[model samples]
Target: MEDRKDSELKTFCSRNILIILGFSSIMAVIALIAVGLTQNKPLPENVKYGIVLDAGSSHTSLYIYKWPAEKENDTGVVHQIEECKVKGPGISQYAQKLNDIGTYLTECMERARQVIPESKHEETPVYLGATAGMRLLSIENEQLADRVLTMVTESLSRYHFDFQGARIISGQEEGAYGWITINYLLGKFTQKLTWLYLKPNGGDVQETYGALDLGGASTQITFVPQDKHIESPNNALHFRLYGKDYSVYTHSFLCYGKDQALRQKLAKDIQAFSAYYYVMNFLNFTSEEPPSQEKMIDTMEKFCSRPWEQMKIYFGDVKEKYLREYCFSGAYILSLLLSGYHFTADSWKNIHFMGKIQGSNVGWTLGYMLNLTNMIPAEEPLSKPLSHSTYVFLMVLFSLILVTAVIIGLFIFHKPSYFWKDMV
Candidate 1:
């Protein structure tokens, strides 16, 4: 009689355990549904946190923006960006030493964490984008890129930080997004400068506008002439780089970036000089007559054993269009020429110094930063040039968490041992 009772008790305990497991599973499913539904819960009137990270071939950069007041009509955005740090061997190539690359990224993020105020960073949405050097590598190289990305992401995870978004996009996407940022700023400058430059009497300014952006491995020429008030997306800015089938308005060239010249061959012969020489050339201009081709060529041969400085000398007029010197480098100057316009050094209006790079002086005079989202039509939402956008990333995050929870619950319902296995 005692043995039978003990066996009955054991059976009762297992049955009770199964019943409890079944109930817990129902609760878990309901919980996941709650998390997913929260996505469409409608964001508050204003988002308090925002961040952006641009990891390029030569450097890594971060920008943080916050909406100060939460009113729908109260569009007040306060933001700060940490200084960019040098991180060579971008994503594409950095994969070789995956661990080292991750460290480079960590250093950048940690530095930002220090600079950003302690109060606001807890929930900042950090967006990171890696380009060129990382995008162009082979499959194995890309895997290395992924491995490093995962590491840096996990490292950032410790701080309750979320990747607002991160992706590896294409050159075209980059060009477009940059143009969007710049062109949005252009709105602030339009009527102000264009009005000022408007040839007094009549008969148009007899000229068009263009931009030259020289990055690590590529140079772009963007131009759009305004014959009559400039049309769609017009504040009259264009991007000539990374567009397909170009029999057209702008021009651009690849493998022509200043940094790239250091690795591969270049037409001009500054082979021996450091990258800063080019920087110095742009920044340090004096009343001193420009160097002679012969002298410049001699300098090159003596330096790179080629007629390097001479080319710069020969192209003196166009190269000089870059007024700020170092800010706009060689690639920018090259694109300046590709504008294929009759631009003397005089044509450079010093856009960087111009009150508003775009739009109305209202944005500039008011001393406010305009988000690309605000100034441009929110439609067609221009995005980073990659398959993974912020929406995509979040969708993935939600999907993963949901899938994982479901798997756990399913295992538990069918076999209680799964609970321990999942935990382990």
Candidate 2:
């Protein structure tokens, strides 16, 4: 009887150990499943930011861009987050009053600080690019232009963000960067990955749109033409984008911008008006008081002021008559596009105007950032993530298999002892 009781007690203890092992295994599996689910949850993105200030002839604009930190080397990853238009005229206009130019940027700098996160201020790069207006200013008055740039640079340096050098960009750079900006925003440089290691349908030939940017002081035309015989050596630009070589024809018509062209038209109109007024004895003018470009534009503005008000009421301020005083300006644009550049009317359909694309403004700033950041890699990246549903399914299937194996091993190890107990 004592031996039988001892065997019964031993069997009871083995049964309890088996129960505890089974409970612990179930709990372990549950804990693992919970941990796996938690680990799989998507984390917040590690984002980097940049700022570019477009100091155009007519106005100044600030653009804030952001991209994922890990995807900086990926094409089409950069995106515009916010854009702030600085009040008042372009910095070039402040040639005589250089001190005020710095003051003009105060509001914009404050706004940028508010828009970008505080932590990114140190790393974020701020660039100031003076466009055609400053280019012309530099040509006409080098010292004054230098003063303007220096003042703006000094002001920008006061801000918390990293200040890159401020300088006047050439017309060629403007055209090329504008092209890059449009193509990148259109996702022309990026390719989608496939499972079979084969390119997607229609992926062999990349379809890219030409960029036509019309600013206040200059206009740019850049396009990849099949005809390699470039009309002008200065207009040809070769670039390797996303491992694809592109031979493009680009041209920037200086002093052909709306504002400058308006000034040009006013100069001609004022010459005629001055002659007529002197002949009529309506106005007095001397050799010392020569009619300047500024005087000409002001005269034209006064002459068209009444007509502009009427034109505004009739056509919402975008009528041909509103620009009738500067009709020569419109004719100049047409002549430049058709005759000067030899852009065929048939090819006009491919030209996309640079104003805004998908809510973001299309400009050289976007391209400028991409180049500085080294975002466009030569070789294509092969890494791609699996689908969300597939990943979850695989994890759950793995967990279930692991649990089954553990339970089977426990059963096998205890089988000898249980069998021995029963036999005894």
Candidate 3:
């Protein structure tokens, strides 16, 4: 009787063990499917389309991005269907004289709509962002913005494209969003990049990045850090503005742009660089008995005639550096910023140069993504290549976790007398 009972007990245990293993296997497969769904290429698989409108102080314009059926995820970045940043009086500056601005926006939309191929037209979602020039408008001039908005909306209504909300974003927001747009476009080839998410946004670590965005109306300086690395709302580091201590460490300094700056006396012969510091340095000739601020203001009243001969006494030995850095036009400023910036001879090679740009779309988009994705790595000791160091650590940790999970799963299946085995 004892042997029979023992045999029966063993058989029962074996059967239960098989049942548990089967269930566990099914659950593992389900978990894998979920992970795959989440981790698979983040880019959309369906036919993709989008429209980006940059409503500026001088002009409102549109850009159309699309992709064919086979090349779904590759839309918007490589191919820009239509890009029209027309030249017009910023509605706010002109105030009551905004009717032409409204009509101009309509024309841009109409031109964009006509250009985007009809096939990809139906499903595109249009997103618009207005900057420096638009944000500074007085309440009285705000009606011109409304008129432009109305004109743009009316023209775009011809197609299935829906109107996205437009915003006159602060400099910090503008800087962040600029980064986001760059990352999204660059995310296509980012997998090939083995370094810091150049656009590491807000997490628990509070990313300490320097954002310098120069736009047509104003410029911004944004510095945000992430507290930690988590995908929850609480994982963000705070945003700080440099100009206003309690506020975001970002500023939208009014009338400091290349165009606006040149029209003032402080502008002097400062037509070379697009940044305030550089421009200020160029215009402030030490030997010429630095002109009064009021005199500088008077100089700007003429709009566009530069007086350079007066600087002969002021430019000592540093004239070459100033000329080199400042000589580029708005379009050429990007390269200068990316070139070897001088920090110290040793560090200058890698110093992330803050080259002056004429716009903020790049910085603003990036800032937005960093905050939105919560990818900021921890604040490790600042090594020479700190970002690279953090990136390597993250990749190693992810690989180890993945490998361990796979090994443990195999062992559980291979061992029959494991923890989940049934007992009778």
Shift of residue 23 alpha carbon in model 2, Å: 5.2
Candidates by TM-score, descending order: 2, 1, 3
Using Cα atoms with residue i matched to residue i, what is each candidate's TM-score against the true structure?
Answer: 0.46, 0.70, 0.44
lDDT of each: 0.45, 0.66, 0.45
CA shift at 291, candidate 2, in angstroms?
41
lDDT of 3 by residue, 249-292 (tens): 33455665554544422222331112533444444422224444
Tens-digit lDDT string for candidate 1 (277-318): 344353332113554323433443343332546646754675
Query: If both were scored by TM-score, which would come out higher, candidate 1 or candidate 3?
Result: 1
Tell me, by TM-score, which candidate is best.
Answer: 2
**Mind giving the per-residue lDDT tens digits that candidate 2 earns over 301-342?**
454455555755655644353345343443454456567667
Q: Show where candidate 2 strays beyond 4 Å.
A: 1-19, 71-76, 193-207, 229-233, 264-310, 316-332, 342-345, 348-354, 375-420
Q: Which 10-residue window in model 2 sums to the lowest lDDT?
A: 268-277
How many clashes (backbone atoms < 3 Å, residues ≥3 apart in a chain or on different chains) does model 3 have? 49
